[model samples]
Target chain A: MNWAFFGGLLSGTIMYGVPLLYTTLGEVIGQRAGMVNLGLEGILLIGASVGFAVSIETGNPWLGVGAAALAGALFNLVYAFLVATRRANQLASGLTVMFFGMGISAMVGRAYVGGGIAGLARYQVPGVAALPWVTRTMFNYDLLVYLAVPVAVLVWWVLYRTRWGLSLRAVGENPSAAFAAGRRISALKYQAALACGFLAGIAGAHLSVALARTWTEGMTGGRGFVAVALVIFSKWHPLRAIVGALLFGGAVTLQLQLQAMGAGVSPFLLNMIPYLLTLGVLLVWSGARRFAAPGALGRVYSGEE
Target chain B: MSAFTSPARRLRGACAAGVRVVRKGWAIAAARYAIVLAIALLAYAVVLLLAGKNPLQAYSDTFSFTLGSWYGFSEVVVRMIPLLLTAIAVALPSKLGLINVGGEGQLYMGAWLATWGAITFTGLPAAVFIPLLIVLGFVGGGVWAAVAGFFRARGLVNETITTLLMNYVSPLIVGFFVYGTWRSREVGASAFPQSAAFPEAARLPRFFDTRIHLGLVLALILLLLFWFVLEKTAWGLKMRAIGGNPEAARRLGVRLGLYIIVAMFVAGGIAGLAGMAEVSALHGRLRAGFSPGYGFTGFLISWLAGGSPLGILTMSFVLAVVFSAGSLLQITQGVPFAAVNVLMALILFVVLMKPRLLGRLS
Candidate 1:
């Protein structure tokens, strides 16, 4: 209702949207490159827990983010080998990795509960923080908040404008043809998956350090799956992922705000908003446009195939 | 003599070729499984060692907790109820190349509906009420899963993601009811957000002087029925055809969309039965967070079994032991319940690799 309230909500959206954005963008890259890492959530969980631990141990959040990315890449490499190289069922293997990630995160993070560590330090723009218009909306967050958009735009360019992006898309659309055309489909796929994992790690680290600012088991809180859904809504485009993530971010923020408004609504119903919106968007978007997944999307690709 | 020698030499060559082919396939298949099992065990051992605990002692403690005594055996049976039924939920859909990961959601919906029925129909005899409640639970879970199926059929939405997201919704729906309309105001249960206990008339009868109830019998019967349907029936054949290749099945005039919806309904219905049995037999009340990842455990079970009906039972027993043991380990060894979760997940990863390698080898 008020300007200040609206400004706070916008800030909250960015804060929440950054993690979702990172995940969706990463998923788009993986799915577009013919690998759907259902293990993205697992990667996030592992990343979040490991990142938190590393950051706590090292006394630096950036180091935590770096460790998270490394963990994500290592975890995703398994998926790349199984689904990409071994040609296993993507859905099953992805789900398998997810369960493993969750289990491992819980197993490792159980000790970190109540560890009481400082979170990511907000790097406010010196002049921007003093400005009346931008102070609440943009100036008060970690560096990742600023980095997310430019990185997304860069991903958008690489996906559409670059020759390597063309080959990557070709690999997803038709691996045999791409292979015949002298493209290294396997190499492209591995790169895409690993890069996606790196971003997922950053997303997980953001959730643990910048958002929740503490270690808790399974704390990624289904955001990875939400990001997976977000990619479909984005139609595998990096730019659209940004929009989808923010919209979801807003939808979630609105729920909390509505609860704060004391509008005689049950908290249980409020919890349903984000999930319901995801399903609703999925249904509506499918009817509106055929969300054509990569032709070779979940298939195992060997050069022979 | 020359003609006889030529014929004998040809036969010997053919026999050697046959043996070589058989040995190659068998060796690869064996190696694949061996590698997976070895790796899973090694990883777990490494983790245990890192934690400064002895894996062997933990395993033995887990052993005595689940497999060593009659009481432990009963606990295993109790754990297997929701687990096997929910595994069927995934197994059924999987046969049609559809992944129904919403067993958790369906289970909660079933329990919620059964709870509602129990409270609303308090006057009926247990015989009448229990059957009525079971049907409600089935339909509730069935319809919940069917929503994802319908969207998949008509909207072309990926059922995997839809069902996964729906899982998050169903529990909250249950929460809305129990926390609102079904919240018991009785002094004993008022502090908790839960439904009132089912009337004595509505409770399920027990078996063998233990907490293991009639649900175990129901699960066994259903598992056999599941085998019959999957292995021998026309519908089962059709499901296998669809899963094998949907385009081919559709070309043969199989109604792909309808079959998918039906498969999901059947899957959801079984999960619902699990939820109903859990409440009516074991808890007698609907409480928040009632399921501690039983649906996910079921998903793992179905994957481990590779959708084979009888295989589910065997895998279920093993996991039931692991689960019962994990809880015991949590108390006796002061180890986290998560260690079991980790171990189960790793087993799934190892098993999932088996079929892929088997195909390559054999």
Candidate 2:
């Protein structure tokens, strides 16, 4: 392949991968803290619709980004209350919240569809952007793409290197033990869920304000679902989430590039590539003996005796 | 074995079993469902208010439009054709502690294979070819579902994730045919993205002067049959035992993997029936958006019903009524279909109210 074609594929990966990274890392945290937000797809929709609308109205992508995260957090507040305090089933509750979020987003987003408001403006870092080879190959994306890397690293650090991370792990592994250890297991779960929701919101903001630049009903498609599966495939590790997201991003970009170069297969058939690859990865990874997960992954925790 | 025992001893055993039946279970269940239903309705009312419509008026209109009229009631029964079949697809797998969320994908494969039968065996008599289409639908969906089952049974993959992912994939394969090779080639209809309309003989016959098709009869019969199997049969007890505790069942010599595969195959086939109904009866031709989210809706139905066949039937009718009126909500109140989705979501959320029986994942 020509260098220009290769560059286009890499750029596509970055565009798609960054948002996935945000969602996957968020899921890693949520699952790590003994909760699984099946409603993530809904959360992303809310974030995308709200983020896109606010940015359009205010003329500030940052404002849109903040609004998206807030929307996600507020939505999760209800879910966390139900699952954490009300002892609802995590899986069912997440699914409900997901539908609720999608409905709310669609109800308001109908007006904003097809309105072409500009996305986040791209600006170059002075020294880093000017490097002879680096400038041409990297550091050339929107600020969000660049930020995703460090944010992931920071998440990794918190999940592995801090006491809070340890407490979260304890809760995920054995909530009863964490409770006996004097950790506020339910409160920690809510915090983890809320923070994860905030990240999912930013991920949606990336899709609307920086990538697709438009809002649509269920625009997140199955990517939110993909991210949830990615967390499991990566074994709930933060850094591994980045790798997994990029690998998926690369698969998607590769197919489009193949189509552009006149691949003979029908585009609809070609669209199955990423999903097939995901299945393949999941099948292979699940075969591993070292496949570890949070002990109490989907169980409802009981704080009282 | 027990039925062959002496009559007097059997009477004593029957009395003991009757005593074992939890009478309080019904009252507790009713109370739990009441609270959850109320909360879900409250949530729907909140959405109605936000849309600037009077919640009470919209509720009355919805009831009158869907349940109050003969036409609306018949329409609800018609919608329940697919819902009924798909709900069984879900409940069967769930009884084995597996979430067969691939109902959507299996449904798609059913439509595809049934379409092939309709198109290929064009010269066959209506009676022969119609049954052939039904068989093809079952085989197509059964095989598709068995793929996830094989993975979960042999590959240790989580059925929930795999089935959900496959659900996203199956619709695309159908779209490929509808949008490309199978695009209607009739003189004036080649412009539309669909198959050539089936011959009259290929169509499923409707009951006298109504939209309802024979699939409704078949679904009702199957529901009664499956309920008997699930409640009174020896094999059904084994399936439930396995679902309750896989490790214990394994210790007791239950063939875990084999039963799981069988359960998944049956689940997928039942779901396939839903797709067959949609294609063979309602749509009359395979097309895009023919059965969007039908599988997911069925999944929610089974979960709401808590795996009871009768509960599934009742819940299916309730949801069918809600969906039958979804369009009226759109036409009259300027609400979106997402509003119905909102309602379903809220209803599903209340399943958590009584977690032990309904929301028990495994």
Candidate 3:
């Protein structure tokens, strides 16, 4: 491809992939704490709808993002109770949270159907935006795009290099041991989940108010679920999660470009590319014994031992 | 060595102990369901009161709307067709400890394939066309599910995400066709987009002059067949063994990889059949909103039933009643159609929270 085409492709991929990256990074933290929040999609939907509604009402996109984060964190409170306190099955509880969030968001969003809200204003780094090819790809993006890379790095630092990170990892790896060491396992789980919710909320807000500039039913469009897969594909590493998001994002960009080119391929078949890729990636990752998951990923610890 | 006290005797004793353990486990499960049911009802009453409607009247209306007339009953059965198929779609994979959330995508694929079959075979008789559409739908769903299964079995990928992502991908595929090559040219509607209608020969025959069609019967037959397979057959035993403990089952000579793929394919095929039924038997064409969230509803039903076929049938009907009545409540009481979804969510939450409401049955 020519330089211009390559630049266009890179920009398109980043624009499409930024939301996925944010959510994936958020989920990487949650999974590190041994909690799988299947409700990510629901949280994203609520965030998108709420963010759009609030921004339209207030004419402030920042407030909308904050509201979305609050909504997402509030939703996770229930998840924390079920998975961390009640000792219920994680998978089942997560599914329940998902359905509940979806229903509530749809109900809350009903009045705002077809309504549009102004999205975040693009930020320009004076010198960077002036560059020939990289300007459009890197310099002209909303605040969230800038936030994603740092958040990924911060998550990596918190999960690996810090004392808090060690405690969290200990809880996920062996809750009993963590408890014996005086760490509050449930509290730590709640913290991770709430943090995940906040990040996911931002991701959702970015999707509606930044990327699509509109809210619709089921608008998150399974991006939350895709984020969960990205986490696995990244092997739970924050930086790798970004890479995974980019890969998925590239697939999505390719589909859109192909559709635009009118290449005569059925759009349905074209749309299947990302999902098919995810499946392929998951299969390959899961087969490698060296990449096995943490010892106690889904099990609930009663602290009996 | 003592010939009378051999390793076979120890194996038999171990088998007995395993049976006892399973029985105890069932007992706990049953008690959990009982508690959940009671809690769900209590939550439902609370919601009814909060909405400013008489709890008794609202519930009565719900029951009457679902069962009062032949038409209402037929609608319930028609709704059950998708719920039944979708439940099986979920339950089967769940048996293999895999969550196939991609049922919605599989359903869309099935509908797309069925539509293709209908459009391409315009001159065929109903006898030839209907079965072909059904088979095509199953094949479409099966293939869709198999992709995820193959990834899980061979690629070591997580099935949950793969299946879920498939849902978005599948709908876009349907959207592409309807918005492009398959769009009906003659319709006057400005807002809604859909495909060309299937010919009469491709439509499913109605059941006893009611809106319900033969699809319900087919779903029920499949449920019965699956129940027998899961509960009585050697293959079912192998599946259960794998589900309960994959490592142990593998040691016992079960083909873990093969079963995972097969189970997912079967699950997806059932979901596909639901899509086909929706197109041929109910809507007569594929549209943007053809599913009405049946895939997710089926997920709820399967979980509520705890993966039992009989339980799925019962819960599907109950869900159908709630769905039908929700629509009625919308028109009569000015409640949103999604209010019923709220109730379902409440029920699900309470059931999962307490899990002791439906004593000795789950």
Of the true interface contacts, each candidate retains a share of: 0.61, 0.67, 0.55
Q: Across residues B144-252, which tens digit of lDDT does each residue of candidate 2 receive?
A: 9999999888956788888888887888988998888778888877776888777778788898577899789878887887888888998889899998999999999
Per-candidate TM-score against the hidden true structure: 0.91, 0.93, 0.88
Candidate 1 local lDDT, B97-163, one digit each (tens): 8888889999999998899999998999987997898798899899999988988888568898988
Q: Would you give me the overall lDDT of model 2?
A: 0.83
Q: Encode model 1's per-residue lDDT on A96-172: one tens digit a residue.
A: 77877887787677778877667877776678667666645556778899899999999999989999899999999
DockQ of 3: 0.40
Residue A16 of model 2 has an lDDT of 83
DockQ of every predicted complex = 0.50, 0.63, 0.40
Model 2 Cα displacement at A263 (Å)?
2.3
Better of 1 and 2 by DockQ: 2
Question: Considering lDDT, which of the candidate structures 2 and 3 is the better prediction for this target?
Answer: 2
lDDT of 1 at B139: 91
Please report, in order, the local distance difference test score of every candidate based on alpha carbons: 0.84, 0.83, 0.81
Q: What is the C-alpha RMSD of each candidate to the true structure, in Å?
A: 5.2, 3.8, 6.0
User: In model 2, how well does chain A match by TM-score?
Assistant: 0.94
Docking quality (DockQ) of candidate 1: 0.50
